[model samples]
Target chain A: MILSDLVERFGHHPLGIGQEIGRMVTTPGLDNPPLNITEKELTRGLRYVAVEAPSGIRGRMGVLGPLVEQAEAAIVVKNADYAFGCSGCARANIQLIYMLRRKKIPTLEIEYPKTREEAKVMVKRVVDFLRGLGGTNG
Target chain B: MARIAQISCGTEWSGIQDLLEKAANMVGAELFFPEVDLESIDKAVEEVGVNAQSPNLRLMTARAKAVVDGAPAEAVLLLTCFRCAEGVITKHAIRRYLQEKTKIPLVMYSFTEKPKLGELLIRLEALVTLAEKKALLARERQEGITLGIDSGSSTTKAVVMMDNEIIGTGWTPTTTVLDSAEKVKREALEQAKLNGRDIEGIGVTGYGRFLLKEKMSVDLVQEELTVVSKGTAFLANRQRGEAMVIDIGGLDNKVMTLLNGVPDNFTMGGVCAGSSGRFLELAAARLGVDVPTLGKLALRGDPERVKMDSYCAIFGIQDLVSGLASGVSKEDVAAAACRSVARQVFETQLQEIDLRQPIIEVGGTSLVDGLVKEMGEILNADIVVPRFPQFGGAVGAALLVSGVV
Candidate 1:
């Protein structure tokens, strides 16, 4: 069974889940296996997908690891949490851009929503980014 | 038949190495007491086995247990009790572990007191008899006689029992703990009219046990608390539950907690004659009076009130002299000294733990009527003083010898 499945079955509270996960990872044995999934493993499972993120340093770094291991198009998702230019999320978005650029993967970035209409527009950008990757799944 | 081992650390007189040798001398029993880390103990046991390849050995805390030729044995753990200020043994745990692991009859002797050479020989005889099949059976069926001795800083005491009728008790001033101990032991035996040969087993308790061990010899040496707790529990005829046992001595103070019929947490102060029985002695010297009469004089105060803040024995005396010049009644001054001692003891014991009611105060110091009365008021609780608080430790030691039966 997956590590997340085990955590879900046993972890009833948020602190409990966090404590269990911390202990599980810290134990001497049972660290590797079907539980440790990589970007290449995700590529084999997914035919069409969008890696959405906010534009910044963190975003650019986030996609770098996955793009280096597997070719995939990226789409940055934005919500009101990033309003007024979030420095933390922006750093993550910048990492994702650097990752796709280094690996020659197709990518796109979009602004987060200010209203309900803007949120719909952000979803459409993610769909269009996946279509440009020569994918089929909406 | 399961094999057993008993590894002892030291004798009442000797250190760790000598104790190891004593354990090694047992017939058909394996013995191991390590000088260093326990990782080497398992290997040492194998090399010294009956067939030179026996694999039944278990290394435990401060001692070892093992099986030799399908027989079980154990080692004793000796520790000092912080509260009662005596050395005691965790003997039963060692015995039970050996019995459970190797399925052999296991026992242990915790060294606490020094016994005379004659007493040591009797204990050795008891051990051999315990291991021997027929003698062990007979001793168990008949119930053996055990004696206890408590050598204090100021006095030496002995408690004797045939099977537990409180046969006789002995007490004498301890010039040197070991020397006084020898005299007390002789006196107790004389009182009981039992020769060393008639004694089944002997246990020693108190701080002076080591000094006595160096002089003479004994079987088991254990802490004062185990001896005192058992004895006090028996005398009181009820389990002393979470109650603070205050032992106010001539030169020092001791406080112990009897939690769930066991003496667990406790504390002790060094030689401070001012806040103990010594305070009364000093007061008696200053007034040119005796100790017993000092208490009654303290009760005869017309004012019935004197305040002496200094707890230092010498400084408090100076304060008392100043108060006397200032027209403080001698009775009130005496009462003030009592209050000083009581306050010091309470600050040391009651400040930390919740002292359960009905505190049992022991020691010759407790005989002071004014002290006991003032302490009762200060504590706002009932204080129970035994008939003879001075002999409590010796009585406790004697009670220890007969407990397991």
Candidate 2:
């Protein structure tokens, strides 16, 4: 939400993997829901990852591909909330960052703020980065 | 006994009351705050025949009417936030209605995120001066020549007032405050064909007022806000109407409300270059255009095509560079930059005040054609840029020492 607010504040659109996937699935279009992945492959992940890995790391790239293609920039927030013994989320996080960096788009990675001061610093950093993309400060 | 009514957002009332009191005391007036509860607000809206959905606006409208009806105050002061959408939407109607009903003076002052103590004091002093019906400076029976010097950050302005008229005015780039003050003063004196000994008194204002005062013996050292308000009010009164004065300086911006030939309330921008003259200069430099030519270039561009998002000077430059790299025209980028500055002023600095027509734009930035155009479009009002806009503060200072304001 903070990332979205910052992106919107700077007059840029904030595209997320879940939102893109949701749109693809709900909207009528020639484009595939997961971009490069087949329906069969998605089923295999649902069956295999749900029972075996449970993290869905194998299908991470396919899901994130559309998000990266649509994004002008990316913000990755690594927090303990997602660190609760989920290997799939961890792997997907690293994969998403790698894919975003490969796209050469501006990216900001920071830990979730715990204290009020930390939150201020974190928000400032994000605001600065987003504003820097425009080549100015507010 | 002099009594003044203050109406403000309930949230800011506590924080600003002490400062308001101090200002009222300066002019020998007592401050009276109206009860700003929902019931009174509802009653006021009903009485004024206006429907207001926003609680803040309703409260302010109600309070203004309540003060005018209940308290026999000399004037009314309304404090509001620049970012309040509701306040901006309803302020004009409220002011007009209150004035018609009460037949008393009304002034509305808006603030950005944070309000500076010094700026607030200057505004309050102006209000108090109006409420108490006291002249800023005592007038002498015999008229003589008086010099007013405004040593600003970017420029020095001096005006020569002889027998109640501005006989001559001079301005030059400011270097050292003392040197610039002396140079401009000498230039004005030369133009007026008068000697230094002919000057009976000198009033100084602006960022370099103290420095100039230290170098030369001056009669009055007034605040920039005070003098600028006095000057704009004097000009507007000559035209015979109320006006909102916007002064965009090199580093700061000031907004003053003039009612009945007096500055009743005012506001100043924060320490950000986003809305200052420096931002326009920086944007122009980055665009490889002269500062004076930037406005013309912007005027040629499509106002709808270019949209600058960031309000920061540095970020605006980046946006311009990126736009150029992405195949955006120079004209569009320049236009977008001008729009962004205007947006910052209207949406951030002057957001809370309901803008009326015939806006008196003063200061060096007022000379920017694109900025003035964009401001008119954004505010949907007629902008009146006075001749010698940069000399407003200096002229006001002269008027101050001459006992005209």
Candidate 3:
């Protein structure tokens, strides 16, 4: 959940906290999921998820499709957990981050805080980013 | 009367089912492949209650359990590929759980994409022999001791056996095949407290088996694969019914499938040192630690700290350095390196093979605790490290000449 309260406190709309695009893709007949997905949706999803390289499985791209479509701006927090057993999740997150960058949307990518000092830096960076996006609080 | 139920990856099952059934018939055993449906998987998952990270592995574990529980087989065989990291990690848990639940022996074999059919046939024959007999071949004590030598790329090992028991074993780093063979022989002789003239025959095997045979005038010379399969089967003894043999040497890695008491199919690593003992040595050197201590240091680190994807030695080192620079702990880096090598072995060497339970790991690299743990975790099965793991090749070589005059 990326700073939804903080972004809202600054008077800009924050997409729902803890919202995942994967849920929309997996669940059929969702109202806000990627629209007009056809039989070749699996292949189209792979085109976005496998932007860096061809992956063996494209099932993960279903999550990325709706996520990319729904987001106006994105904040990606990484390194909070290791990607040992969850390479698919990491790959999806990375693909989404890359897609946001390519779309030229206001994007912020930050590493998870490892120390108290780093935590302060993270908050400051988020606050600055929100203000730059025309938030009133800063 | 030994009925065996074999569970393999769906893809691998299609390729070797006929050959496997033929081998089973040859051994006087009936082999059955249980249907691994979603219902069985769900039931297994509910019973196990442990969440395996990979859905494929979760399903496999569940299916294996369901088969053992429902099938009329006396033993279970699990076939796994190298690319399935989840299988390696959960192999032990599955084996123990199933054995406790079903009271049946379980065997696992990891295979490569292209396995040697000849070697597979030999192993299958051995497994059938073991299953039929339910014990290793019994031999009366013979006069004079035989020396067995395994001349590998990185280490030379020698074993001296008297009256079907190992009297002494010795190993040292390889300089030349002949020199290392002689050095190990001398050490074994000294340990056995026997004179040089007491040695009646010398058997040789390994990558330099031919060289050692030519240099030392050996009495019996067998292929390294044959000796290793024999040695693992011998060491496992009755446990051979459910045992899978994995030998990770300096330059090569071998995986053998045992059904009942026989070795059925086997696979070996390619020319790359990416998954061999040399890879660990280099990674340890880069970390300023010895290879033997790599496992201990890794156990001390959090296994979930960082996962490295690269299996190439060069790329692995680069990943290690990058991980360290990124503030990953030293122990975690060490663990990641070990894990990476283990993963590489599974991906490159054992990708197409079926892995089963009670895996027996031998060879010089088996001495490392971290590698074993990593492999065990990846396979999720019981790992058996026999006494003198590194001497298995030598012991098998020696056994060939045990009854010889």
Q: Find the candidate with the highest lDDT and give its number.
A: 2
**Residues A43-73, candidate 3, lDDT per residue (tens digit)?**
4454343212223323455535565677777
**Positional deviation of B240 in candidate 1, in angstroms?**
5.8
Q: Global lDDT of each model? A: 0.51, 0.68, 0.67
Q: Higher-lDDT candidate among 1 and 3? A: 3
Give the TM-scores of the predictions, in the order they appear: 0.48, 0.60, 0.53
In model 2, what lDDT does residue B185 have?
Answer: 93
- After TM-score superposition, what is the CA distance of residue B134 in candidate 1 from its true location, in Å? 28
iRMS per model in Å: 33.2, 25.7, 12.7
- Tens digits of lDDT, candidate 1, B1-405: 212233443242344344434443532333433333466555533332211111121233223332432323332222221221011112222333343454233333333343233222222332343344322122211135767788776777786776555566778877878778878878888888887777766667776876666666576565564455555555554363556677787777766666544444344555567668888888877777877777777766532355565778888878777778888777877777777777666644343333665687877777787777767876788888875576667665555544433
Docking tier of model 2: it is: incorrect
Using alpha carbons, what is the TM-score of model 2?
0.60
TM-score for candidate 1, residues paired by index: 0.48
Top DockQ hit: 3
